[model samples]
Target: MYEADQPGHGLDAIVAQRTPRGGAAQHGISKKYAMHHRSGPSLWLWHMRRGDFDAAWTVSDVVLEARRGTACPHLPRHEQWVWDGTPLAGRRVLVRCYHGLGDTLQFIRYAPLVKAVAREVIVWAQPKLIPLLRTVRGIDRLMPLHDGAPDAEYDVDVELMELPHVFRTTLRDLPREVPYIHAKPLAAFTSPIKRRYGRLHVGIAWRSGDWDARRSIPFALMARIAEIPGIVLHILQFGSGLEELPDGFGVLHDVSDISKMAAVVRALDLVVTVDSMPAHLAGALGTPVWTLLHMEPDWRWMAGREDSPWYPTMRLFRQERQGEWGPVVERVSVELIRLLSREAPQCASGRSGD
Candidate 1:
């Protein structure tokens, strides 16, 4: 029933079907509606991603209260029940993130907003985010929820991404503040990068995880981006994309940690990546990032837009046709040349000194 692709189906239909004869008034406050609905929160996210803010807010509150052994069984079982909108004056709140690195990076911007009310905000995050998210402000404490890691104590718990719905955020109200998470360029790589290649200093990350083949491009196609004149290309790939490069090509640095990777990113003139965490990281660091996207793109990038609201420094390169990367790469190459020609090259802001 909740299939997103189903014809004539929408959030309003679910709300209407679920609401009793008295409408939202009857079903809203009713324990029956609150307890029994299983797919409400997922539906909320579906609408939220589609930019239907009004429809998404309907289930925001109830879905969060979901827990094991209750009538609500929405989210995975957390040791402690989440207390939504609870004033955290002197409370130690646990901001546990369950999604992938990209999701965590995107939503962790709300940490400062959460800090305004909470006395102490402890971020319980995956190992990958620890190196980066550790730099986020308003976090009183940070802990890694790595494999075999033990649980800790807190007054309340929350899924980090859901903070947007809790705060009633709209497209206009999004926090576009750069450097929400901070990392410095490690001199170890920076010194070598500068001494060797001092052109435009472009970084390329052409792949995402293996789950989505559509989001990734052939490395051979990505190498074509290096053909741009007077611009030094650095491969910012992780495991799979790493390989021996052709001579006179970009250097693939040995970066095992996020902090080290971020530092390298900060040192670059620009980062060209797919829709992934590195793009989010570059945007977070206030770096000039040009992100290539798929035809049916992620909701965060929005539609028919070259710029993103979440990251002011980001310029999007989208696929004109589905299952194609040639057009996207061509446009990116043109933009790279244009950016390199500038006396004082810039993305959004001219903070190019870093």
Candidate 2:
């Protein structure tokens, strides 16, 4: 047992609060199965949430060793378990992305590292992401993931999420370098932002995917942010909640294309977003980002922390109370005002005698 994985590392409190006995039943999962699996991946998540990467990696080692020789499960490609703890050196490796877009964007940083050891690295990813990913290094081939079978052949396969375990990544070893995913500003997407000069151009995305409703902030609440002076707000949210956007809240944008969204994010001075794809995109591009989170966020944001080790440019604002976003919004507004105030003097000096 690693020192971080030992009893005093906050696991007891996390498991007790996060995984009550009946919690699985509330999600339509069997209590028996959930209990059985809780000690493995679930434990890993708890450790990760506490920023105990050493413990999480310890759990991962147990998992990989236990299931090393098992055959791939009979299930859909996205649900299928690949990567049976095989070493990647000198082999053609297929890295399948069987998770959300944000997950892929975060973990794909490992590709270049993987390529350092493997003979060839082929990324089977979401079709929409292939264009943006072309900007990344160490990929010999990029293929779209689909319902049909993949045409590329490989000696071994691994899930994108498993790369951290493969590398025995620690908090210190976790990738913090940015612009790993790069793109130029698309004129169509960035025209509104470029037109507004000498103002803080801030982009916002308040909605997350439907898997967790707690992650999404009410768009109407964003009016407080829009009221801040000397800052131009651009709405980078795409998908279901656009109708909730109050009139003239910000410049509405078509962020349906991931690559174009990257370009627009690159053009912005700062990005303020919920825990969504846009947040990952901004962080990946080396753009300064402020991520708002609910009381208990995903493991990536971790607990009791205001900064992310994964992306150095990212700052986190977390809720003190569950489902209460007013305080969080107020703090963000206050900080934005302070940011603008600091930059105002610099702007005035540059415009002097004009």
Candidate 3:
């Protein structure tokens, strides 16, 4: 039932019986049994049933074995295989990822990197991410979750997160280019906001949903920032924090959609935010951004670099110690004052070093 023209390519019937698994599942048993079928290097498709404990455990074991030189690479390690780029070149490849927007964003950077070395890179991602990913640079094609075996079109398949370690990436060697999302057409500011906030608009996001305890900045800290003169702090965040916004904190605009968020971000002179998607988006747009990272930050932020290689216009402000926004906020406050006081320079003129 598979052909080159059909979605399944050729192994559609075989994949029909295989159930797909989600992240953190095990697949050692499947790999152990599938080893007997090798003929001119046949491809073994391992399907992980979502939330299946046994399956998750088996897959984890399979991955462990592959890393230890026992079994071949499977889901989760698939991206690593692609990055290694030797075994799967000139062959069809199937790639899968855990289901989440952030997970997708963190790993999708490898798609183009994979495409650089592999003949074909068919990605299996959560349905919600498909629209956002359409604008991403490197994917050859995409299949929604639970799509049957990748057909005869794939000579190999692997999971998404494994790409980095497989490529033996250290903090110094991360693929640091901006790769996840592209700049969307930004809407011009409406006459009212333009007149009310004036030309220099700054966007701020103080909290990230995933890292609430560690990532949230004290409201009082943001309040100190608002107190800075000649600058407007526009609240671009949505959800629960809106209720607690301090009085006289300038305008609070509800940005519920990605496109609208992009537009408002485009209109800003700068974005000062905690580590969140908005910071990433602003960096991607080459907008001037000051990103505040926690003491023990995400690996991507790395360590000891004020400037991000991925976003040229982005600057990093790390906490000197854990759970203290006081010093960081104070530093930002001082920097903002300096930026405000300086006379506007001609276009293309570089500002003095920070």
Candidate 4:
């Protein structure tokens, strides 16, 4: 007896469970399909990493279909999977944000698309993001996610990550539009910063969340960037890495308020960050951003692509080898110099100073 709530049931039990007599349409997909994709999650990631979205969606359908009626009430929202090939034609869709801040930022672009068809679009997002997400177009209402039941009623539910699959998105048709979420420029940050007109005000964030330390570059290594001329660095990193910043490297800004953070990011001329929330935020706001990636980054970054299809203004700097920041930093330095050399006159004349 395999139980959906059992902590250690694993994939073997997932496929081995006897299907309800009603069969595939009853939400139990074919056993042969399940057996072939023994590692469904890994296979899905592998397909996505290789940019085979059609194949990835096929794997997603089978995986999601297999668990259509299953229940795991004890799991946290972030761990619980939602959406089961449900159509959103005329339903009240509850778009749940059961993931990290960065994940929410990246996928919120799909809200307009969802609103195009659904009767009502309700976003249950992380509390910190509510102020910022309020500015995004097409959301009928916004609710801050909490420990209790959701505040709104909906005909169907889907996790924010599932939006891409729901739309059957491909690299060619990915929602690549910039500035989907708008943030007013912070008067405090904008007025003072504009006074310094000649140097480019480049915001830099070198750390990522602790779940994956590999995604972050050491604060000391950021010296390579600090040495670059004609660019004034503003430190966008918050939490643990601030202590590691050497004296006079950059001006550290408070990122406690996400809305203010968005305003600061929008005010900057360019953002250079690791694969973190800032990267997603900058990309979402349509600001020019350079994302430094680990050798094997998350599947979203995909494999061997310098520019992201999801963000037209983003440029990627990938590690040729795992755990080596030297080459990645060197390449960024060269590019920074070239960019400054080309944009010098405009940067000097422009108000934001980039």
Candidate 5:
């Protein structure tokens, strides 16, 4: 088993204190599962209360099993568990996820899969994700998580990350295809951006600070790509980076709403982004995208592949070496230039081409 010295005694105490009504025997499984750190104590408590010890224990076993296999390195071993032996048939199931659009996008792929097995599948997502996740397949309803607990009740509830393993996913078994999220057009607003940059809009996102600094591309590299002619780069970054556009880069600053951003992405000719939400959004919209990836990227991107199974229109550009954004950026730049150059004739003739 992938046993590491239990690092947080405080957290262990928290789990012990929150032990469900099943008493210490069941709590023992909770404690062992908690050692995996795939979820929080509250989630464990929620599972125990629902009598999902079998599901919870399955999560624990899967983590231990994976750690002993070769796939352990690429897998997010810290983020999975088996379902307690509960038959999901006829049960109302709700899926939960913490914040982070990339994570939601990755796991939401399984929502439809889950719905296939369960009578109902309600996705409880962070508020920020609700707008986007509402469009995903297999979700009967979108429930916003509040106060770290599911706002709605269900017969069985599982964390969103746990769905893949519950379904026994391997690279070969993954649900790979694009446009899984079917978001409806809310309302159209005339973009001053269109007037300013003349058709052929492209969105750019370069950083996600919380996901490890190494996954982020340098601002300088993004600036170079923005300098490419004939393509308009709209900035879709959240928080401080929205105001941190590098010199000579044209960014649409007025986009504050995610729905509007989704519209803008849909209207774009292409999207070039780091491994972030914009990439997932673009994929969901069936928009053509070129995603920049770090060498040791999240498992959804998998390893050593130029195409993503989840998004048909999305292409990937990976770092041949770790922490090297320059090569990836340069390759993207060249590819963009070539793509545009090839399409220049089509543009001259007033025709659209890929």
Candidate 6:
């Protein structure tokens, strides 16, 4: 996908090769798996679609080892061997966030778990995300990833996404504990400009990062869900898809900043978003969130599922057909109606008090 002028049907071959029953047997090349991050998170995506997480380590490790051949300044020519999954009690440890913001949000839950055993845990992350991640439970230090690793001597280091594999996790062993992350809301966004117009305040995100369109929801389709009764919908999206929004809908402006976005999510009665960062943020905060997914969604959501093991607060609403969100949105609207009905009296009582 990185190559714009790539060969014909390149993706079909890539997807087919990595599919569960595909020829990429033994989890690697020619009947065995190779530890290469070069494939990016696609390895995770592959196994995740099949609900197989045990191989996550193998994929991530391949990438870590492959770093030796790259020009990455931080991954100099082998000063120290990569840290195998060992007890970190007295050893200095480093953890780098090498993926997207959403992956980082999902995996950072492991940092506190990592910190429990490690003597010290230093996180090297995207410069912009540092401020947001600083408050997470187990991190002793947080720094932005510059050209190279920071000037610090460390006994061992690991990538953030690799922690799950290091721990040998299974679906049964997922850290379903919500509220692992601690975020501070911007004081500036203390109140919404518009007063309550519905019984339930719902925050919605229909677009993802500027990468692929596979996971995004068209504003036109998403707007239909806003038509549901007793629900106030606020857009939690930013970037290119902004122009497509329906009139009178407010864009979730402060949401572009993860921390402030978190604060906003924390305040919502419920979050209805596509498979994006806001869903992860809402889940991490233990807020009630309904994740509207694409027909063929990411591996994290898994296949044929309505709930996520990663976040107890999250409920999945998947598209019934490819490139079509109407059914999904309609189903969500029905559920929303049912949910708001149950809360009608409570909403009425709260309004009376107000």
For each candidate, how many residue pairs have backbone atoms clashing (under 3 Å)?
1, 0, 23, 0, 11, 8
Tell me the tens digit of each residue's lDDT in model 1 across 1-354: 110012212223323333333433434454644453555435654676677676666564443332222332442222223445565567777887655666677789988888987767888887766878777888888888754433767776676755775577887788888878787677676676666443677788877766566778888888897777676788788766666456656876765677778888888878999976789888989888999999876556766778988899999988988989998888888877776667332432223433
Q: What value does the lDDT take at residue 350 in candidate 4? A: 42
Q: Rank the candidates by lDDT, best first.
A: 4, 2, 1, 6, 5, 3
**Per-residue alpha-carbon lDDT of candidate 6 for residues 1-354, written as tens digits (9 for 90 to 100):** 211111211212223222333234333443234333245456656776667777654564443443333233342211222345455678788886655666677889998788888889998877767876876888998878765557667777876755766676789898889787766443444245224534677788787755567677878887886677677776788666788876778545556667778777766677898877788888887888999887776566788889999999899988788888888888988998999978765543231100
lDDT of 4 at 320: 90
Model 3 over residues 211-259: C-alpha lDDT tens digits?
2458768676877887776677778766546666867676665576555
Question: Which stretches of model 6 miss by more than 4 angstroms?
Answer: 1-47, 55-89, 184-198, 345-354
* lDDT measured at residue 284 in model 3 versus the true structure, 0 to 100: 59
lDDT of 2 at 223: 62
* Predicted candidate 2 versus true structure: per-residue lDDT over 105-223, tens digit per residue: 88899999989999999999988888988988899999988867779989988888778778888887787788789887766755655556567888998888765788889987766
The list of candidate 4 runs beyond 4 A from truth reads 1-28, 349-354
RMSD (Cα, Å) of model 4:
5.4
Candidate 3 ranges with C-alpha deviation above 4 Å: 1-86, 126-128, 143-155, 168-180, 188-199, 210-212, 246-249, 343-354
Two-way lDDT contest, 4 vs 6, winner: 4
Q: What residue runs in model 1 are displaced by over 4 Å at the alpha carbon?
A: 1-54, 62-90, 147-150, 195-198, 244-248, 343-354
What is the C-alpha local distance difference test score of each model? 0.68, 0.75, 0.57, 0.78, 0.62, 0.67
Point out the higher-scoring one by lDDT: 3 or 4.
4
lDDT of model 2, residue 78: 43
The candidate, 2 or 3, that scores higher on TM-score is 2
Output the lDDT of residue 151, model 3.
37
Best by TM-score: 4
Clashing pairs in 2: none
Worst 10 residues of 4 by lDDT: 1-10
What is candidate 4's CA lDDT for residue 138?
86
Model 5: how far is 250 from its true place, Å? 1.1
